[model samples]
Target: MTGLAPNVQLFPIESILDLVTDGVLAIDQRGYVLYANATAHQLLGRKELVGKNCGLPAAHGVGGTDLQLVRRGDMIWAQMRSLPIQWLEQAAYVITLTDITERKRAEENLRITAGVFDNSREAILITDSNNIIVDANPAFSHITGYSRLEVLGRNPSLLNSGRQDKQFYAEMWKTLNHQGAWRGEIWNRRKSGEVYAELLSISAIRDDSGNAQRYVAIFSDISYLKEHEAKLRHVAHYDALTGIPNRVLLADRIKQAIAHASRDRHKIAVCYLDLDGFKPINDSMGHETGDQVLIEVARRIEHSLRGGDTVARLGGDEFVVLLRLEKDHECLASLDRLLALISQPITLKGSSYKVGASIGVSIYPRDNGDADTLLRHADQAMYIAKQSGKNCFYIYDPLADLRIRSQNELFKSIRQALEHNQFEMHYQPKVHLRSKQLLGVEALIRWRHPTRGLLSPLEFLRPIENTELDILIGNWVIMTTLAQFDSWRRNGLEIEISINISAYHLESPGFAHNLRQQMALYDIPLGGLQIEVLETAALADIATVKNIIEQCRRFGVRFALDDFGTGYSSLSYLSRLPVDVLKIDQSFVKNMLEQQADKTIVQGIIALARAFDRQIVAEGVETEQQGEALLSMGCEIGQGYGIAKPMKAEQLQTWHQPAIEKTR
Candidate 1:
């Protein structure tokens, strides 16, 4: 009933063919030409096949059967299909020519896409809108141990192990439909019925009508990833070796604990514990053993702590204990009990170790609410505990810094000393008792602190050592000593200023350059400045010492061995060293008169000095008998409380008066 006649037709047939972009050809009952469309000739490559007879083989009108045609070096596909059509009151042949070039290209693309999906290391599956598996690649088959035929038409739930709840699935569906995609972890079962963890990603594909027609899922076995992630988590939040809460987790705990205490208006005790003599153990027993001991110690300390209290190792042999004892003095008792347990000796591997903990106690929300500051104060208190001997704890005394309160106030006072010239240098005059003349004025540092009055190095230097204020105080010492030498030269005094260099100064890489620069800054001669270094640290690093001493000596600056016999080195080191003068440590000088061995040692040193022809200055001589003893033994010089107790710089010029007049 399909009409193609010129008249009496209800509807036209071209309208139906127009719906298809493919080419259509019709033939008459005798196989004679009836009609042909433009695309059909183009598809056949003849371009003039209208009214052609259909008796020829179907391949003749087209390029060829199964033959590749090249246009611009591109393969084009031609397909022929014949159908029966009614036209002119008889059955006619309707041959359809479809230019499947694009379809073939698309097929090739789909094949490549399929190849990739099959070869992928990650499992890939495609499903219909209902989540029933329509296709699965080789990777999915390999991962789930299921063949393509076995999984196809089966829902993805076939692989579910029921590990995820219905709510999780609902959330996944909601997320996918709302966001067009979802990705997460899930537990799935293999064909062998074994369960495994997998990371999964699902995507919904919609048609032009905007309704989801298909879904794509990608997954991977995440068992190895889970193991690795767990390892990193431990390393991130807990110490790897000790398996205790690390600094990050401990700080977090402290912060959370402090916040809770603050809400309750309660006080929290934070104790910082540092193992005493732990360094010696680390050095002697090796780091492996040290780590074991720390783990054991962490366990013991945690065990000893009261329930609900947390003990976190802050790396090394340092630990922090958080006690949220808001009522009654429970924290103190708990801390004491834990500290006692920690003090017990630990036996590790084959060695028995005894290490005491020095604990610094700080109360949070009371002393301070901030976690970092509280930990710092606890650290300071720990040092105080160390000062009171080991195996003990100390509460942070706010008045600790007050002991040097006046000295701190003396910064301005010291500044005034610098400005109004209230500052002066004292000299403990070194006497050449053999030659019996003033040799040198060792510049002793004295701060005419206003509120604190005149303070010696002993009274203020310890504080300087424990703080950065040492640099300021050190600068004053250097500037004032150099100025004194300038004064002595102005008065025609030839004596050198013997200034001591702290290890902090000497080990400073810029020390030699800075000293030379300072000499140039003040226009003072380097020859008149004698830098005295204590023997202990001066010899500790021989290479560094050699480099520094050699570099400074090049500027015509000289060095004297101060506190000579105090170091642990043998005498063989002295004759070969770069030092210019040997000042016998006062400890050796004090016993020289009474101890025959001290006399022999001094005599040996003097004899050795005479052989090397080095200047020998005997220190700490209060008695003339000591001086005479040194002088008779061929010792040449002396400086100590014997002459004057480290006098001010102003006293040095007149100091030579008494000794010079005594000889004259």
Candidate 2:
């Protein structure tokens, strides 16, 4: 164990082997373990191995061969080297054993890592310092539709889509060189002659001196994801029904239009349009036909304007047009063409339907209104055009809309009165003309204005007609009438009461259902409640009114066409409307005795009602002579001051008692 001379014979073999760190083995030409050292016994897990044969092959010139050994039930690796040495001064072989379990484990891990690199799903590419692709994984070939042999030694530029410019590549390299990595979206071409988008990441493999030796790129195709994103973006900004810019995109477009107008010193005209007489078609033909009509309308409006102009549907049959104009006169021509185009006839389901647009224009910079205000002003103008006999366009006039806007206070007061129960229903008696018999009463709405005393519908109702206010006030009238009827029924006043329903309420989809709910809430008899709709309301959408009438009839409710002959009522259209009664307009009745033309009109209406087998009620009858004339003309029912003026619910009982007694 001390020291040995250069000659192996000068040292004890066992001592020399014990002093060495490696396992020393002596074997004959047949490879038997004749001499085993302490380290070899410990590594091989065997002690009595003096005659055991170690069958390990020869090592290649200083490079050791690997030998497997079992130690304490665990498999381990050892480096074995066979050397020709003097063993017991006879011909023999010496084997050196070195434990290399940790090194073998490192090599196994490297093999597994290489396998993962070749089999990953993401395309993998490796490039040398000269930017030549030295290796490509199977995934790279699958993604690019090329073989690894086809792409090896070629530059990655072969897959370039030519979408990235020289500057883009320069910036990419700059960032990659500085940060040691680069990741972003890129466009690349496939071997199948298709271009696609990909999310790519490149990492620099550096040498010990910090110089890049190779680059590893990993990428995934993201074309489908990008396509899905584009689809979502389109849906967000476009109307699914019409495939045009919706309200969301329209606002953004208007903002851009305004900015452009301001910079170029040009004016933009915002025109708000509404289709006249479209409701009846939609109500009659169903929503499918309605959708077809709307599509055609959109197409016509879009084609009617110049290329730069935009027409967007604001829902329903309403559309907004943006016209770029250099002068005020330009608006006239554009509006004229649009109106003409929209008024053209559209044929659907083998029937020709004609609808006209009422257009209201507000010029930017000239009107001094922003996008929202301009839209509102144009809407106001559109209402004027409709009131002025539609199928026309009108420029906005602030002075004209002043009175309309000024009614905002009165509107607020009406709403407050409704909320506070400051409104009342007045009952006007409709009586049998020949016998003075008590018939049903018409319920009229009256506002007890606190400051202005009692106000008739004529004073404030006209301002809110055809608006949501009308719908609100109409609902109030209905609920109040039902409650009043319930109270009257409790007191033995069993007369049917009819409440006038506005066009807005009559055309509402839930009108019949709402009425049934209210009737149920009040516990009133079904036939005890009657709905009086204006002749104009019925004309607005005949099919809708017919459906509402049919639905109400199912619940034992009756319908009466009020103020008949005041609208464009024809026998053909009237034949489609199902109602129980037709009330002659007061204008024709109030002066029928004084004016012969009024008398002829009333006679004709009475005759028409008789022909149609409809009960005729004369309104505004103020004299016994007028009642007698109506009776003579075959009109039996009369309502007005002559029959009985509209009286409070409390007065109704007392006023009806005398009429009942007189009828006896």
Candidate 3:
């Protein structure tokens, strides 16, 4: 009955072995399988594995060797261990198998992660909870110029460039504690003691309880980017030619200067300079020479100027100098130095050239001008300096510039009118005051403006006095007068013509020769043409005017001293020159009858003319009373609105016929 009990104790052993998921087997010392549990058969994928030798692997290696089980076209890794145990009352070995495929895979992933951490381009550093460096990757050593052996056990603060203060680190730690991470740009030093920029990101590794166990920092070197940014900044603010501040930078400096001046209650002078003769050299010698000259000039200016002053090139041959001064006169010394430097001989390519500068200074707040307006005023002043004389400096004068601008417009208009033949000669009749007979006509220039009808010489002539435009217009009047004289002579009107001549034109070296040539060309006799020269003009150089008059007399060309009574040397130079006519200035003639002083001056002028044996013609006689007064003073010839206001040539001819009949 007990033998037939179905081996109840063996069932308990089989049930205990089958309860485990891991494979369990009993093997004999000969390596033959004695007993196998269901888990073993299922894990091995073979039901016939038990009660067979199976040539199973033995646990004979140094550490319990691993065995491979083939199951349903898949291989399962197992860790096998054997130990001696009593199995079925026989000497046997207990074998245990544990599937370890997933554990192996997990270990492989950890190895890959470690490799990636070491091989990354970015540097990786690990620090303990106390902020001391614990480990560093190869890339960390390469980037920070420090080896792992050198960095381990040291604080990461060793790599600090000292660019960040304690406050910065404190803020960084505060951010790290609040956010568990911190990322930003930082400056660090390399092992070679060279500083570098880095983009660093740090993360705190926390344990399960959310407490930081270690700190991991990843950093990338960004020194190249920093250098590039510096280059961009330089290019933006510096001038290419002079290597100094450009307009963009100068604006910033000017702002600072204004602030400083405002605080100190001092004056700031803006000096605008233009080289006097740089253009001619640049055009003639080549741009290379010009560049060299500019370089030298910039160097000299920058060095000679006081510190804290800024000199900037506005481009081309223009430069702007900012000077802070305690007084207005303080600018003078700087200006003197600038002028001296510019005057120094510039030597280039074995050739020496002299250059000068014209500077214009505009004072701040005093002129009430802003930065741009100050520059504008300085430029205006510079032009004035150029006009007065080059190699000098000028202060901005608003009133003077206003007058200059107004006159400049007149000068330009006069030039344009001359070019367009907009000027005409109006002949005013000069008559014998007693007989009322027409003697001759004086030629007066009138501008026939296209827009504004006729304009008298008084309206435009004074602005161009003593300028090249005066000479040009004077020549024009002469040429046109001679041609009119020829036309009148052809028409049987034998009238002598008196033309006004400027002092500049009269004093020219070859005036006599040019007059002679023109008379011959026009086929006109010298007796019919007379030049009316101002007394002041003629006496400017008494010897020269006397010689010129004598030279003209040889050709029978007459000279008259126009505006005789207005000059101081009228009486003194009267005897020295052989002039035929004395045209009294209209100023005295027009007012002689009004004021007794004027009457005395007119009488004295007429007496002097007679004593000198020179014919006198009174001008600007507008009324019969003035003409009668001049006649009473022994002046016979007079021209005025009282005698047919400056008629055209044809109108003069028509009036002459009737006047001749009346005289007869």
TM values, all candidates: 0.52, 0.54, 0.62
Which is better, 1 or 3, measured by TM-score?
3
1-664 per-residue lDDT for model 1 (tens digits): 1223345344466666645656677776565656665555455555445455534233244343333444445667756666666766767667776677777889999999878987999999999988889999888988899999998999988888988899999999999999999999999999899888899999999999889999999999987888899888888999777777888888888899888887888778889999987899899889988887788888988777667677888878899988887674786687688777777888876678888899999887657648888888899899899899888988886566455566676454555566776555667777777655877778777667657788777765654552345555556667778877777788888876688776566666577887787777665775778888776753446677778988989997888878776677736457556777888888888997789888788887777677776778888988878888887888868887776677766666676677778887
Q: What residue pairs clash in candidate 3, if any at all? A: none
Candidate ordering by TM-score (highest first): 3, 2, 1
At residue 88, give the lDDT of candidate 3.
64
TM-score of 1: 0.52
Superior candidate under lDDT, 1 versus 2:
2
RMSD of 1: 15.6
The global Cα lDDT (0 to 1) of model 3 is: 0.84
How many steric clashes does model 3 contain?
A: 0
User: Scored by CA lDDT, what does every candidate get?
Assistant: 0.76, 0.85, 0.84
